[model samples]
Target: MYNSDSFYLIASWRKEECPLKLSELQSKFGWLLIPAAVLVLVAFYFLNPQEKPEENLQASLDLIQAEPPQQTETPTQNPAPTTLMVDIKGQVAKPGVYELPVDSRMTDAIDAAGGFLAAAEPKAINLAMKVVDEMVIYVPEIGEEAALPTAQPGAAAAGGAKEALVNLNTATDVELMTLPGIGPSKAEAIIAYRTDSGSFQKIEDLKNVTGIGDKTFEKLKDSITVN
Candidate 1:
């Protein structure tokens, strides 16, 4: 409330007074420094941020999708069987022409024919022998004389008479082809065998030719002769 004299007196006191203390200066500015420090801490936290939970989850999903898929295996199938027509007769349960695998035996024919009859003599036949196309399998009755079973499919001559037997010693390729299961290649092979190895000495000697096994011989033996 004083005039210019009071202002002059206050200026003179300030000039003449001792310097202010460090404790007093700190007390006045400490409240302002607290708010400034809090602002600095907030800015630092925003600049250096931590990883988010959503980002970590998304990275895991991307890794799973990028992986390779598993492979599947394919299935395999078995080959079809080569078939042969066989004629079973006499004392079997049901005797007739039957289709069997090419590698079938006499026992297989008997089973295909509904097995042997009660009076059948299975001992009379070669059960373990390999059966070929058009082969005859005869099961004789008990105590009966069984004629030798031979392969003679469509082998009848004119007027119901038996066909003349093929002569392996001098038969031509066309003549050899008349026999069952003898094709052009086999007929030619027979001629080649005879030219290289002379004539067949006996019917059994025909087995010495190439491509002729016991099974092939069994098919040819009944329809061929060397004489």
Candidate 2:
């Protein structure tokens, strides 16, 4: 039923309507156009290949991570000597407290003290006697009478010239009781006193005991010793 004039009119109306619709879309979606453009640029930037890092930078990082820690060296110290103290007196070149190796003999002590004097009686003490801590070695002169006795119990003088003396510092309760006028009670008291006050400095210190007096000390003075 359409004629040529009708077709022309329809084409004109469609062209006008197309232009109006495009204008309406631009006005309503103007803000949406900016956001769409930003999205496209972001996508392009992310998809693009990035440049590789420098080879030297990666190598330096690996070197730092793979490196071993430095070690600190400790210095060694000199060990102290294992030794004992002994006292050498009478007829020796040097007479005083001296340090000697453990298990050293009487001759070793004498040698350490510069040997014996010309008048020293070598028979006064046993040269083979082992020296101990706080030990006292006395070398008497020739023709000199031995007054004090040996510190060790039942051990004779060097030439068996005198009796053995009791060591007050190391004597047991039974040994002390053997002394004249020293009963069991007195011996226990002496041990208790020495324990509280430490070793006796000299034989004369025995008089300092609670029950011992000058008379009792005199009886045992020649028989007792402290070394």
Candidate 3:
């Protein structure tokens, strides 16, 4: 029985429905669920762990473990045993080309020249001087003017004319008896001396023997080798 012009329903009374509150507003986030699922699928697609290249890794390890090649050296060739060619000049009786063993010294070259001509200044030449291939050895004699022997007027270029060698280790009773300035008894004395001491380590050791003098030692030095 309200005013007839008022907006009202004239009917039997019925309960009215209330509007939704804060809890119901949560339903709007439901739309975001589909995109969140997509992001998760993409993340795993890119970030999943991968297997390393094991074969390549193993090859590197094998290289490190392998041993290096062993080095080998080849022996050098022995130089052909050479004869020293020496032309003896000056006071020597026979001043000619002499074929001397390698390592020959000045004094040996003089011997090839036929020992000093009595008046030679024996002390003038240093016999211990080292000689080389094709070297000329000179001996100045003191008194008599003897003509030095030259290559025979027409002799072939003698590859080497004469050869001589003295052993440092084993010259015997008569062997020691022949050195210049040495006599048989003195030779015996030399043998005794060498036998008493050990084998000669150097030709210089001969000086220690009673009979060996500066001239003698000088004369022998080039003609001998410890080996």
Candidate 4:
């Protein structure tokens, strides 16, 4: 029932309005897509399981504390006591060699030798003197003359007869020369040795002299004594 002009106007208006509405809907849908993408990323991050750095460190510390402590070892000490050999002779109930501690005194030696006899002279020797290795101790009889040079008793004479032994410490050079294997030169050497090195502490000490060796000491050992 309308004319050609009115129909053309209505078609043009509809075409323009349809294009504007489509553009507005596309802009709105693009904004919604951005928010939806952010939500998906957040969900993926929380879904995967992983240990925290602080938790891993604390677990390592706990494992170390659970182990047992180490034990420290203490060192052991076992020390042996020192000992010495002593010879006790003359006037005692028993006369023999005995083993004694290094700190043992003369009284201890007398006790080891069955104590002194009734005729023993205690004041003749120093009872408080510390005993030495291979030392000789002699207890003289009461009223007997104190032996010259030392408190120790004399050794038996070299001959078959039993006579008072020669005192090496007090004997003259001529007397020393009288012994076997000793000559004037050897006597002089012995006198010089005793003069330089005090009185001999033991018969073995004679071996320390010049020109005297183990073989020479072997021959003289039985003929000498040191108190």
Candidate 5:
């Protein structure tokens, strides 16, 4: 209810005031800046290009599922089949009747007897030979030694010196090498003679072999057998 003059004066003062109104500007824009900053941050979080969470999630799932299976240890197995006893005799360092387990061969018998003497021919015995219960195995001396190396797995320890020898009648080439003066070639000749002719009927009959002579016969007669 100002008087007309006062009202006019008041209106004119307002018009002559500074062009910029600081209070009104501050009031209107101050509230707007805060809301705008909040909106910008929210938009940036949602639309960021560097975000790839699905692959990271899948990798995490793969790591969890890729664990390997648990291990289980196995026990060792025992050998099968049974064993038996046999006699071993020969030029082996230790000759005796061995209580060997079977599925055994002649070589096994020799091994049980502590192997051969230095002069004992390795080729003298048939190693692939199979073992038999109570079978006689004979190992002969390599040379003219009295305490002869010969053995007949059974009747051996006290046998006569002559009995400690080979039986041309029943020997293989491997066993023939056990003779005092025989070797591979000479043994082969004896074998050939045996195959060509029948068994030697007597000591004199061995002379029919090409390699045999009076001297050779003397060396072989006692050692060779007819049966």
Candidate 6:
């Protein structure tokens, strides 16, 4: 009975003392806890580094630089057409050599030569034929003998009139070779003579060629013309 009273008193005293001690401790240390918590948050903020503005910009630039540039296809161009020289002679309005595109036809050459004249025998020549370099396009007149042997006087009578005759001034080597007794050498000789002496004024000028004697001239006399 006596011990119960003592124990109750002691318990009451200890409870009051504990509350006083706890209040004092809280008053003294509560402000310190808040500051310590703030310090810990500040240290954490400093330790966890944030990205720099320059670093972010550099990263963006690097990313852009890492990518390949877009490729563009280049357009192809067509090759230019080749040009060639051709001669247009005889009955054409403008008879001379003309520059033309490769694969150009005889009609093109004739057109470049100012077209054919009224007396031009268009049927006597191949107008659709392609013109070549150093080519000669001769447009003979109607009723002109292209190739005839003067030795045969009856043949001219039989034919009524002379057909289209080869123009000596404008005849090509191939065309001159078609004459009687005229080969490649003789045709070249005729071209050489014409080139050196200019246009022959008369049919007798044919004898002036090296190989063409009186017999050769007689064989080609009536068959040839100057105009």
lDDT by residue for model 2 (27-139), tens:
98887999999999999988995655787789889999899988899898888758987766667898778999988887898999999899988876788877766665667
Stretches of model 2 off by over 4 angstroms after superposition: 1-81, 147-227
Tens digit of lDDT per residue, candidate 4, span 124-169? 6677766666665656667643432222333221111112344567
User: What is the alpha-carbon lDDT for the whole of candidate 5?
Assistant: 0.63
Please give, for residues 45-162, the per-residue lDDT of candidate 5 as tens digits.
8888664799889989999889886789889789764675555454678867787776778778778889878867565456776665554455555552222224455422211122
TM-score of each: 0.32, 0.35, 0.33, 0.36, 0.31, 0.35
Best by TM-score: 4
Per-residue lDDT of 1-227 in model 1, one digit per residue for the tens?
Answer: 98999999998898679466669878888798988999999999999997899999999999999998888987877866599887776677897889998798878888999997888777767777777766655555566433333345654221111245889988887677655445577778899999999999998987787767786566447668888
**What is the lDDT for 14 in model 4?**
88
Better of 2 and 4 by lDDT: 2
Q: Itemize residue pairs with steric clashes in candidate 1.
A: none
Better of 2 and 4 by TM-score: 4
Rank by lDDT, highest first: 2, 1, 6, 4, 5, 3
**Candidate 2 minimal-lDDT segment of 10 residues:** 154-163
Error of 1 at 170 (Å): 1.5
Residues 28-85 of candidate 6: C-alpha lDDT, one tens digit per residue: 7888998899999999999998999999999999999999999999898998759977
Taken over the whole model, the C-alpha lDDT of each candidate is: 0.71, 0.73, 0.58, 0.65, 0.63, 0.68
**Alpha carbon lDDT of residue 143, candidate 1?**
66
Q: Model 6: which ten-residue window has the lowest total lDDT?
A: 153-162
Worst 10 residues of 3 by lDDT: 154-163
Model 3: per-residue Cα lDDT over 1-227, one tens digit each: 46754434332222123244446655857677799999998998789955568977997889977968678998998898778677665457786788999887777888877877765666656677656565545454453212121232222111111124346578655444333334466667767887788788887888888857786566446445556
User: What value does the lDDT take at residue 206 in candidate 6?
Assistant: 86
